[model samples]
Target: MLGQIDITRRQAEIADIVQRSGFASVEELAERFEVTAQTIRRDVNGLCELGILRRTHGGVEPPASAGNIHYSTRQILNLAQKKLIADLVAADVHDGQSLAFSIGTTPEIVMQALTGHEGLCVFTNNLNVAFTASANPSCQVTIAGGRLRPGDRDVVGRSAYDFFTHYKVDIGIFGVAGVDEEGTLLDFHEDEVSARQSILANCRKSFLVLDHSKFGRTAHVRGGHIRDVSCIYTDRPVPQHIQALLEGSETRVVAAQDTV
Candidate 1:
C-alpha cells in the first residue's frame, strides 16, 4: 500500500506520459511503474473521473478534445521541425491562391509562414489559424462554423463539413496524429476526421504536414488514406514501409533536413 503522497506523485507521472505519448496501455504503464495491473487500472480510473485521462480499449489517452494536451505542449513538441516543414509548404503557396488550413500545431506554424501573401483567400476550422492568418494584410480568412473546442480553438462537426463543401480550394494543408503501416491517416476525433475528408474531397491538391514522431503512433479514428494526398511534408525521413506505400501510390514525400 503506497502512501497518499506516493500515489499522487505516481499518478502525476502517469498523466505526463499519456499527455506526451498521446496513448498508453494499462499493461505497459503497469510495467513501467512497477505496479500490478489492478493498481494501474485504479489510478487510470481515478484520472479519468477527474477528466485528466480518457479510457480507450485497453489503454488510456488524452481526452479527444477540449481536454486534450495544451496547445503549448503541442507547440513545443516539434517546434524546429514544424517550422522547417511550414517553410517548405508555404513556399509552394503562390499569391492569389486559395488554401484551407486544418487544425493542428503544424498548420498554425504554416499560417505564420503565410504572413503578407497578397490576394490569398484562406479558409480554416481552426480559430487560431483564422485569427493568425487574418493578420496578413493581403489575405482573406474564413472560419468554419460549428461547435468550438475551446481547448484547441478549433471548430468541428456538420457545420464545418458543410462550410468546406461550398468552396474548393487550390491547396489543403493538414496534420495527422498517426500514419499506420498501410498509409492511412489517423486522428483522435471522428468529427475532425469528417472535416478532413471534406477538405480532401474538395481541394485540388492536399499536403500533409507531420513530424517523425507520428510514424508508428496509433489513434482511434481514420481520416483518410495517404494515396489521397498530393504530397507529404515532414522534418524526418519516411520509414521504409511507409515510403514503399507512398512510392506505389500517387503521394509524393517531401523531407526537410532529414537525417533518416
Candidate 2:
C-alpha cells in the first residue's frame, strides 16, 4: 500500500481533480496537468488499482459504490490531516473524562493523541483505539464484544450497539464514511450506523471527526444528520452547502488549522 508520502504531486492532483469533478478524461487531465496522455494513463491506472479512482472508458472517476476504500489504504490516506484533527480533538479533551470512540482511522488517531492524558475511561468497539488508549496507564479501556473484522480491526453488530447503550460518556467521538449534501451522515454498513447512533444517543457531547475528503462523499447506509453532533472537527472549512445546513443549529464547526 502506498502512503501519502509515496504519492507523487501530479498523481495527487489528478486524484483531487477526479474526486471533485466526478471524472476526467486522460487527454483532458494530461492537458490540464501539462503531461503526456501516456503519463496520465499511468497515473490513473495506479490510482484505480489502489481503489482511489475507477477507470472509465476514456477517463477516471471516483469509486462509484457505497463501500469505502480498503482499510490499509484508508490508514495512510490524508494521514497528516487526520493527525491535525486528532491534535485539536485531544486538546479539547481533559483528564478524568469518559469517552466513547467509534470505528475508523481518524478515531484511532484520536486515541493516539489522547495517550498522554491521565484518568480516562475509554469504551470502544475498535481494537486499534483500545490498544492505543491503553498506552496511558491511568486510562481504563473497555472493548465491545463481537466478531472481529480483521481488515478494519474493529467489532460491530448487535453486541457493539448494546455495549454503547449501557454507558453515557462525557464525550462521543466518531468518524463517518461520508456526509452528503443534505447533511445526512452515511456509513458503508448497517452495523456501523447502529454503533454510531448508540454513541450519539448516549454521550453528553458528540463530536463528529472527519477530514475534508469526506465532505461530499457517498455511502450506502444513512441514519443520522450532521446537526445531531455537538461539534464537527475537520481539516478544512466545510462546503457552503453544508455550512447552510448548520444554520440555526448549535452544532459548531471546528477546522483544525483554525486552532493554530
Candidate 3:
C-alpha cells in the first residue's frame, strides 16, 4: 500500500485527470507521472474503492450515475481545493452587496469566508449557508420557506424556486453536482435545477463554484450551460474543449492555482 499522503495526492490528481478527460489509460497515467504501471494500478484501485472512479478495460473513468454522493462525504472531498476557490470568490465580493447563494458545501464555505464582511444581505435556501452568513452581525440572512432536506441541510422545491425569483440580487453564487462533457450544468434533482435556474435568472452577476472533480461527472437533471454564468471559480483549469467554448464569451474562468 502507498503511504497515506502519497496515495491521497496521486489518487486526487488521477481522479482530476480522468474527470476532465473522460478517461485515462494506465499506461498514459504511468508515463505522465513517471511511475511504474503497477503503481498506477494500485492508485486506480484505491480510487475505485472510493466509488468515485470506475475501472475500464485498460483505464478508469468517472462513475456513471444520476445520484450524488452522500452529503457528508461530499463536505470533505477536495475540501482544501474548495477553500482556495472560496477565498478567491470572497475577495471579489465587496461589503454591502446583496447576494443570493445556492445550496452546496462550496457555497457554505464561501459564506464562511464572507463572515467578516459588513453590511451584506444574503438570501439562501441552505441552512448551513444561512447560519454561516449570519455570523457577520452586519449581514442580513434570509432563508427560504420549504421542507428541510436533512441529508443536505438545505431546502428545495417550488417554494425555494419562488423565494429566489422574488428578489433580484447583485451576485448569485451557486454550485452544481456536475458539468457534463457538453458543458451543461447538472444536478441530482429537478428541484435543485429549478432553484438554481431562478438564481441565475435573477442575479445581475452569476458565479459558479465547483472543484475539478465536477467537470465530467454525470447527473440526470440538467439546468443551465457553463457559459450562462458571469464567472466560474474552480480549483483547476477547465478542459480544453470547454475552454474553447468559453472563448469570446462573457464568462470568466478563474482557477485558484493560476491566481495564486
Candidate 4:
C-alpha cells in the first residue's frame, strides 16, 4: 500500500535507493515497506516502463539501462560530434584487421562510420553495436559471450571474461566515464569495468575515445590509468601539466581539434 505517501515522495525514495546502492532487490524492498513482492514488482515494472529504472535479475538499477545510450537518445545527443570522431577513427582501420570494440556511444558512432567495410573481424561486448553491424556483409561482428548488462546495452560477466582470454585483437577502442591525472579510466558501473579490463587484455593496443566533457569527471569504477593506454583521442588537447604526467609512458595524447 502507498500508505498516504505522495507520488513524489515514492519517486524520491526510489531515486535514493538507486543512487546510493546501485540497485534495489525485490524481496528486500517488499518486506521493508510492508508490501507483497508482487506489489514491489509492479512498482519496479512501472518505473522501468517509465524509463526511470532498469530491471535486473533480482532488482532494479539506475543509470537505467546497460546500453545507457538508447537508440532514441543516440539520435539526439551530441550525435554530430560523435560522428566526427567516428569518421576519423574509421579512417584508421585497414582491411583484414582484427579489432575489439567496447560498448559506448562514441564507439557506436565508430560502427556507424564503418558501414561499408569488408574483410574485417570486429569483436565486441556491446550487443547494441553487434546488432547494428551484424547485417553488413563487408564486416563480420562477433559478440563475446557474457551476461547481459542492464542500463547499458552490452553483454558482460564470466562468459565474456573467458572468451577474451584466448582472443587477441589489433586494437581495442574504449570509452571512459572520466579521466584523471592519476591515469585511471573510470566508469559508472563495475560490470562495465570488468568488460573493459577483459577487452584490454585481448587487444594489442588500447585506444580511448572520449569527448572533452569526460575529462576531469569522476566515476565509481576505475578501469586503469593512462599508463595502461596507447593513446587517447579527445575533442581538445589536454592541459600541459597533464601531458607531462603522461610523458615517457605508453599514453599518446591526440586531439581532434588539432586535426580540424
Pairs that collide, model 2: none
Candidate 3 residue-wise lDDT, 1-260, digit = tens: 10012346777778767866989999999999999999999998987876668999999988885568755446656878998999999999999999999998899888888988999999999988888877778999999998888768889899999999999999999999999998999998999999999999999999999999899988898998999999999999999989998998999999998897
Q: For residues 1-260, could you state the per-residue lDDT of candidate 1 as single tens digits?
A: 10011236568778768977999999999999999999999998988876667999999998776433555446645666788998888888899999988888888888888886788999999887888877777889889987988767889889998889999999999998888888888988888898888888889999999988888888879888877899999998889988877776778888997533
User: Residue by residue across 1-260, what tens digits does model 2's lDDT show?
Assistant: 11122667677777767766888999999999888999999888888887778898889888875467777557656777898999989989999999999999899888888989999999999998998887778999999998998778899889999999999999999999999999999999999999999999999999999999998888889989999999999998889999999999999999977777
| Residue 91 miss distance in model 1 (angstroms) | 1.2
Whole-model lDDT for model 1 versus the true structure? 0.83
Weakest ten-residue segment in model 4 by summed lDDT: 1-10
List TM-scores for all candidates, in order.
0.74, 0.78, 0.76, 0.70
lDDT of 2 at 26: 97
Runs in model 4 deviating more than 4 A are 1-75
Tell me the TM-score of model 2.
Answer: 0.78
Each candidate's clash count: 0, 0, 0, 14
Ranking by lDDT: 2, 3, 1, 4
Off by over 4 Å in 1: 1-68, 258-260
Question: Model 2, stretches more than 4 Å misplaced?
Answer: 1-66
